[model samples]
Target chain A: GAGVSQSPRYKVAKRGQDVALRCDPISGHVSLFWYQQALGQGPEFLTYFQNEAQLDKSGLPSDRFFAERPEGSVSTLKIQRTQQEDSAVYLCASSLVATYNEQFFGPGTRLTVL
Target chain B: AQSVTQPDIHITVSEGASLELRCNYSYGATPYLFWYVQSPGQGLQLLLKYFSGDTLVQGIKGFEAEFKRSQSSFNLRKPSVHWSDAAEYFCAVIEYGNKLVFGAGTILRVKS
Candidate 1:
């Protein structure tokens, strides 16, 4: 079976440009999550979705970061006006249950703001 | 705030040597603990998890972790490591919002 997948494995953008990252979760996965991993650091939670509902977005850094999982199978993370600080790898994960389940992660999209 | 800690930033061991990576969490009760491995330019791979019962849990790739409630620790151990095991290891815990809080990670360097 296929695991979680993300698009645009690498992205390069100029400062102030907008960027969007896509994630395709595993089939029938009810829970999805997004994380950001900075260079030489552990990944930090960004947001979570259960089905089509955006249950938690507390980890989103600022108003510029927005995520949507309209149909519950695919999710997107968008950033308005990219900055150098936003240069990092964005990771997506999915699980069979809502919580306490093993999260299968995608390869992630590395965004580089030049 | 809840957090996970990996005391060692890096560890270098010869092939076939025993290995242990420490992990500690700050939480009121026992939370779901997990160990994950990530190779360069790859996503995290679940090694094992400890939910309940059985303090010692075996994971894939010949890895095991022991959870100690009294110590608030879940340390990963391997009897003999292989050269291919060189990668980054992370300790994570499911916090209040069902999101994982990860530690700074430990880089394992296996010398053959």
Candidate 2:
């Protein structure tokens, strides 16, 4: 793809439900990132991947949030037992490489937990 | 720990007027700074970045930002504002291992 692509542009889940969001990064990109953006706030870092290796998970908010980039290209973010506080826009970004390169973002998935 | 601060939560500017958005950062070493713009229902687009070299870096949409080491500030500016420029702007600092630490965004409202 010419740019990063994300699926399920919008999702509504009830409390205690599990939801998954997917991301397809730009071809040949070596770095991928996930972020969460709350209403009227800046995007916060969630996790990072260098190819298929999950190098950084320090920013994940809680145990309910898990992300995986199995093939180094496509990634998935799964939230278990979703809470109302989990409602936010999940963003995916990719860069040519991890160092100093500008990241390209995808139209995020807006998840509303009820 | 690296962090960014955007003091103004909202800014309103008339079309054709000059605009400036303030940003400050706290980091131990030389910081890699970036500015991004996000429109309604859209993804974030990088406006400009400051890694090294000249303090003033030019970006797309007639935007520019100056990185000052002493004050730990990287303020974004545009000579003239346009209605199309209404959007949320974010300031971020690249942390160790290429992580991005972002500040609370500043929403810009352009009046025509």
Q: Looking at every candidate separately, what fraction of the true A–B Cα contacts under 8 Å does it contain?
A: 0.82, 0.80
Model 2 chain B weakest lDDT span, ten residues long: B94-103
Best by DockQ: 1
lDDT of 1 by residue, B1-112 (tens): 7899999999999999999999999988768999999999999999999999999999999999999989999999999999999999999999874799999999999998
Provide i-RMS per model in Å. Answer: 1.0, 1.1
lDDT of 1 at B16: 100
Give me candidate 1's TM-score against the actual structure: 0.99
RMSD of 2: 0.8
Per-residue error (Å), model 1, residue B52 = 0.3
